[model samples]
Target: MSLLVCAYVFVPETNTTVAINEQPKAPFNNLFGFESWRQTVWDSPILRKHNCTLLNSLSSQDIYAGDAVLLQLQNELEVIKEHIDQITDELNLHKESFAFRIDNAFEAIRIAQKVTNGIVYIG
Candidate 1:
């Protein structure tokens, strides 16, 4: 069997939150956050991808650490929680798979906040 390993690289904050959180300038696309593998997994045709694509976007930079970034992370957790609730209602029969992923993501966010002292950055 092939192994699928997940790796994350943490970087330090080099500038203040303003420098990092500014709503991307004209040259940029103004979008934030990284797409999780959850996206790809749910995209499978057999899975019957529903309208529960809420956790797909994050409103802050993934490679920077700051209060705004942490806030964004927290917000994402809340979003996931809400999505979980909605999805559970819609797909009562198959809530385990989705709920498990949401739970894992929430736990990951909590751990990152604790370990990094609210300064979690992805590289």
Candidate 2:
């Protein structure tokens, strides 16, 4: 089975305390899939530095605020771009595909940051 990593922009209605509603009204986009490449993301040194782990990283159960996590992901994107060669070599990932995935993830986070009370949902 393939486990897809997806990101969404969620804006809670005013007066609502829930982070994620039972049925999310906002639309979401798929960023990447954690299939054969799961290990690459799970073991990323940059992600690790940001406290992302296999179990918690990008999962809906993540306790960190979405904006905070998205900020960390943005930082990771810069580092990944700077050390693309090394990261690809270390993770045995396709450079182009990995770059594309990271870029899409960043874009999703960027959009999420624009809305009031917006948060990212990754699963």
Candidate 3:
């Protein structure tokens, strides 16, 4: 990423113990110590312990490294999505066949009903 250098920034710092530790504005900022913050975050053992961590510090730009990885992952996801669609299509086809069978049964019952009604004439 880019360096966020803001000159004349009003960063609040209120040390309850010592006024000497105060920066400029009100409220405490024991959490935002400069060198300690750098060491804790940029120089932590979680990152610094790995040999690959040094490469991250070297790069000033090209912050969106995950884009290429995500693009590849999206392609894979699309393939899986297509497979799921195919499976769903097959399932729906089976359901349609079952529905057609039911329709055939209902048609047979309707034809039998008409036949029975034809013979039961009271006129």
For each candidate, what is the lDDT? 0.38, 0.53, 0.27
Report lDDT (Cα) of residue 44, candidate 1. Answer: 26
Q: Between the candidate structures 1 and 3, which one is better when assessed by lDDT?
A: 1
TM-score of each: 0.40, 0.61, 0.20
The runs of at least 3 residues in candidate 2 whose Cα sits more than 4 Å from the true structure, single-residue gaps closed, are 1-29, 44-65
| lDDT string, candidate 2, 1-123, tens digits | 344333344435553333322222234344554654444564556556544453235433432236666676566667667777876787777998777666655555665566665554444
RMSD of candidate 2 to true structure, Å: 5.9
lDDT of 3 by residue, 79-113 (tens): 33344444335433344433332233223222223
Residue lDDT tens for model 1, 3-97: 11111224457533211232222332222222443333332222334332232322122334335655665565465456655545554425665
Q: Which residue pairs collide, candidate 2?
A: none
Give lDDT for model 1: 0.38
Candidate with top lDDT is 2
Mark the 10 consecutive residues where model 2 has the least summed lDDT: 16-25
> Which runs of model 1 end up more than 4 angstroms from their true locations?
1-9, 13-54, 58-66, 83-85, 88-93, 117-123
